[model samples]
Target: MKRWMQHIMPPGTKCMCIVAIVVHLDFQSRGIGTALVREGTNQADQDEVLCWVQSSEAGRRCFENEGFEEKERLEVDLDKFARGLEGLEERDAERKWGTHVWKYMVKFPRQVD
Candidate 1:
């Protein structure tokens, strides 16, 4: 939807990109993640900025539930990516490796500026 956004978003609109959000394993299922993202969107709405994020699977779900839309995707071999992290300690479960897909999600303003 990157193309769509570029086409639809009015001229001179600003965007706020969320790098990431990590909730502890023990704190999963609580609304903290959603709340944090929601606050970002709310502020963006009031300030007329477009909210954006690059989210993982669970993060995509949370943002999507809060009305974020998928705009783009970057699929890669997470194993290779992890392997490139030289000298970094890793666990045995494929060392956080798999078909890693980074999703670009966004929340547009109610009315484009």
Candidate 2:
């Protein structure tokens, strides 16, 4: 196990996962999200880690700007997911985050000398 970890992990890297990345609604359209993600990727670069994120459209834009690449995309039909919700029509479902999924992405940041 120790040998396995050493071989797979770079010098300073460890197991790291970013389950969620959200900037405040008030901070939207600003560069806050990009900065946050850039910092995260920068750290990953130093640690020799490859970072992953499941990003929505806007979130996708942020990561993409920072050089993340899409590995996969998943879309959910809310009508199927919601089944029998009284007020959520298929069209209405389009308007909610509850109906969508991210394109899986990974980022490899440049190593600083």
Candidate 3:
């Protein structure tokens, strides 16, 4: 967690990090990802803890829709990792390997009345 996150989650506040959520290709765009995030948020709310996740591009929207806000981002170049690997030339041509972005997002527990 970054120092600024202290403002969102005061010192000693309990926190939870959701590492990953993956939906099958055939099942995507059907709200499954949103449902998963909702479940996590619900649990965090019940426990009164802040919830967070490092989300890929595909998962960013789901997390956002679940009330998570982007706090930080990390970008990695795929081409650098794939360098000197055979057969990547053709694949690179097809997709144009580029930077992959990961966003660190957080959602504070909803306040109770």
lDDT of each: 0.77, 0.72, 0.83
lDDT of 3 by residue, 22-81 (tens): 899999999998998898899899888999888898888899999999988889988777
Q: What TM-score quantifies how close candidate 3 is to the native fold?
A: 0.78
Clash tally, candidates in order: 0, 0, 0
TM-score of 2: 0.70
Which RMSD values do the candidates have, in order? Answer: 5.7, 6.0, 3.6
In TM-score terms, which candidate is top?
Answer: 3
**Candidate 2, residue 20: CA error in Å?**
1.7
All candidates: TM-score: 0.72, 0.70, 0.78
| 1 against 2, candidate with superior TM-score | 1
Candidate 2 lDDT over residue span 7-70, tens digit each: 4446876544456778889878889888888888888888877777767876888888888888
| Stretches of candidate 2 exceeding 4 Å from the true structure | 1-15, 85-99
**Residues forming the 10-long window of minimal summed lDDT in candidate 2:** 1-10
